[model samples]
Target: MPVAFRLPLQVFYEREARHPRQPFLVQPIGGGAVQTLTWGDVGHQARCAAHWLRARELPQGSHIALISKNCAHWIIADLAIWMAGHVSVPLYPNLTADSVTHVLQHSEAVLVFIGKLDDWPTMAPGVPAGVPTISLPLCPAGDFDYRWADLQGCSPIQDDPLPPASALATIIYTSGTTGLPKGVMHSFGALGFAATHGTELFGLGEGDRLLSYLPLCHVAERMFVEMASIYTGQTVYFAESLDTFLTDLRRARPTALFGVPRIWTKFQMGVYARIPGKRLDRLLRLPFIGKRVGHKVLAGLGLDALRIALSGAAPVPEALLRWYQRLGLDVLEVYGMTENCGYSHVCRPGQQKIGWIGLPCPGVEVRIDQAGEVQVRSGATMLGYFKDAQRTAEVLTEDGFLRTGDKGEQDADGRLRLTGRLKEIFKTSKGKYVAPAPIENRLAEHARIEQVCVVGDGLTAPMGLCVLSTVGQPEARHALQDSLERWLEQVNAALDKHERLRQLVVVKDTWAVENGFLTPTLKIKRNVIESTYGPQFQVWSERTEVILWQD
Candidate 1:
């Protein structure tokens, strides 16, 4: 099916004209209060901001950077950049000063927008000394050249400016789990195709509501919340902070929600903390009480009204999906990358396969090469990596397919099930190759385990290293050790001789973003983990105990 393509600004203009008074953005200020902006309000602010940008007379298609957590002003700033015929470059709000400096210098962004952030002091030094900056509402204390208030009195740009569909829209940097981040360039037409076809495929429209809590710099959130809202005319709500997430969720009562695997796991753990999982399971098996309990639990989480629940950014464990399924929520797994505008595959509502990432999306084509890497071609494919032609040509083929680097297989029905990353496969001392993701996923089925990494790579056999969840932290060491031993035995029973784990080691330190163990998107950095723990691997593997503790 050929879908109609329209630029994001064009769609926003139409929505603004059709329903000027409709609530378009719901932003949570401080102190348990929210300010709802109508389409008219957002249009006026965006137009005024656009006028401010145009007055500066920056070069055509100048790169303008935006650094902020998800907020109303973030979207307004993006609109202003597009209207002023400039390209946007969004930096993750959680990036370090070094990363911020690298992106700004590489993109050559002439101007920057500073918005809501938690750690401004650490990142403020990265903005080059002379670069101009505009501050958005809720921004941390800084000496910005312009503030949101400064744009209030400017006359709104009367004419609607429509850039060509092929114009560059944004440059989203990769999460850089392995090395330095690469800038992925996406055109307006590419993003428009994803937003348009995705909205139609998901049956989204004006009645839908979404909460924008994920980092807007991520393609998943940009396509799901920012671009989708413009295409579907849906209302977007911003989460205030981690402490008030539940409060913000309840206030929004969004009809659609998107969460990553870690968030879902945390939610499950939260539920277990209050109502023991065993007791909740028993209650959910009962006749009339099961329905009531399910409704109550979902309502408590402020997801009772969610018509669509999506999980992406990382592979979700099958056990986690099943747990949510028992609770009357079907978390559809989605698979895509920054190179494809996050619009490749999705598990359709009725046709969801537990472990599979589902079929290719409406206009996406998927294939598996001889090496088992998943390759995708779509209208939403990126133009290429910005200023790195050699690297771009290596990943994107002459035929337009993007090498996804994920090893996967397709069922007879065409659903894609990812096994592991091609680059992550390692050889043991015996020259036996092992893929850690499948083993880690199997070990993660145990409720006590929070994060698991299987390491062997030149060793005789692989071993599992894990960080305990909050639920597992308080349990007696002996009991927890016995439980892990039994779980390890069960998991090993299903593996091949060479693939069986030699032992399980419980690490003392937690894996987190701040400590350099995880990326901003919460994906584990394998190189960092290996470097930090590699010295202890031989000693731990030589131990006799089935479950060893880091001493």
Candidate 2:
């Protein structure tokens, strides 16, 4: 790792008060131009918003909600919420009205700031009646009690609350893949410590850059993009839309990049589209010219400047890791949950290990319980699930270890390999237990499969129900069947008796957040998958073909 980039929580105050004109946030504007907001600009706008809050005379720790996509105003509102001595509750912009109402009611929020949204009609009804609302400039629908622009003409706050380390910073709700999402509370100390620890691990600073695109409501993106920029003074770029993602990446050319497994897989697919895997494989194996070949490929993907590329939030395929390594990109896999501020473990660069999440972070303690569940304790561990005392008690042990629902094995070398979620391990009709994660990891490398869920709940053996990649259609299935069959055979040979997949059924429909198959953070909803495809499992498993077409 490079020299540790240290910037305390005072970094934000100092940047605004001392170096006011310093570049901070870069916002994408229409007509292809960009807008740069300086620290001074942010401080002023935040002060204005703080004044608005002060005028309202809300309770000292009253909950305020922020619903928006990633944008400059979103961060400003967060800062102002804290400055005004209120706790912020952020909701995913795409959340349904019922979920929105659940959070607003659960958190007891009195005021909300609405911002960029793909669908406002569904999100609007979620706000509880009598709650006041302010609109961020990014909001498309433009319906709100007050516009963020209204704050522009207001005077700056003469005095603001100076919160101590113990003050609550935010309550980030978990992207509910199973049950109702729980709000994970974080103190200012925990958030600051997480950001400082991140800088130590990644060496991010003023010279570095970040692209803000993922939902800001999620802790991973919030930590990496928003908090990191505050603590390290990194310039943050906002992606205009999904269409300009590659363009944004190319323009930012960030030195540090973090993506979930799906993003990395998408990048891999993009590369394969331009250069056939066999041809690219040959180019990398050449003598003396291999390095040049890699440089060109990475530059094409706008990853040439990346010194640190991380993949997490799910299991990454071994084949995908090897594929990137061949192209001179080492994508380290980090593992953590929202309850811990995502600071549990990360694979160190140059000490590469495939199929295992690396050593514990600087101050984090990790252990495997008798149930084989991964438990963690750290300064960054959340205070508790908001307004859910019983649920909090269920997860936290007497001594304070957070019982991560994930089941894993920690090696003597301190690397942890996740097996599956404790509740996700299903027993077959034969009374044999099967862990689907490992098998799914193997199948995820299939070029035609975007996501795969292995199910065997009441069957003799497990079968895969996969949502095809863009090219994973019925026509391509028959052609790719032989190759996939050979690969599945190899994977099955390596697995235990009950873990083997009998067949893979390809589905025609897509799985997305809009379709209710995915969480806001893009993690697949296993329960939804089971409900949608469980009925077809019998027919799929009964088929003689190793890879069967369902659509």
lDDT for each candidate structure: 0.91, 0.85
lDDT of 1 by residue, 1-551 (tens): 66677778889999999999999999999998899999999999989988988889889899999999999999999998998889999999988999999999999999999999999999999999888889999999989999988876689999999988789999999989999999999999999989888888788889989999989999999999999999998899999999999888888888888888888888888888889889999998999999789878989988888889999988888999988887888999998999999999999998888889998888898889999999999889999999999999999999999999999999999999989998889999999999999999889888988888998998999999999989888889999988999999999999999999999999989999888998878888999999999999998888899999886
Best by lDDT: 1
* TM-score for each of the candidates: 0.98, 0.96
**Candidate 2, 446: how far from true, in Å?**
2.0
lDDT of 1 at 291: 79
In model 1, state the lDDT of residue 38: 90
Top of the candidates by TM-score: 1
lDDT of 2 by residue, 71-190 (tens): 888898998898888888999988889989999999889999998778898778888889989998878775689888886667988664577768888899999889899999998878
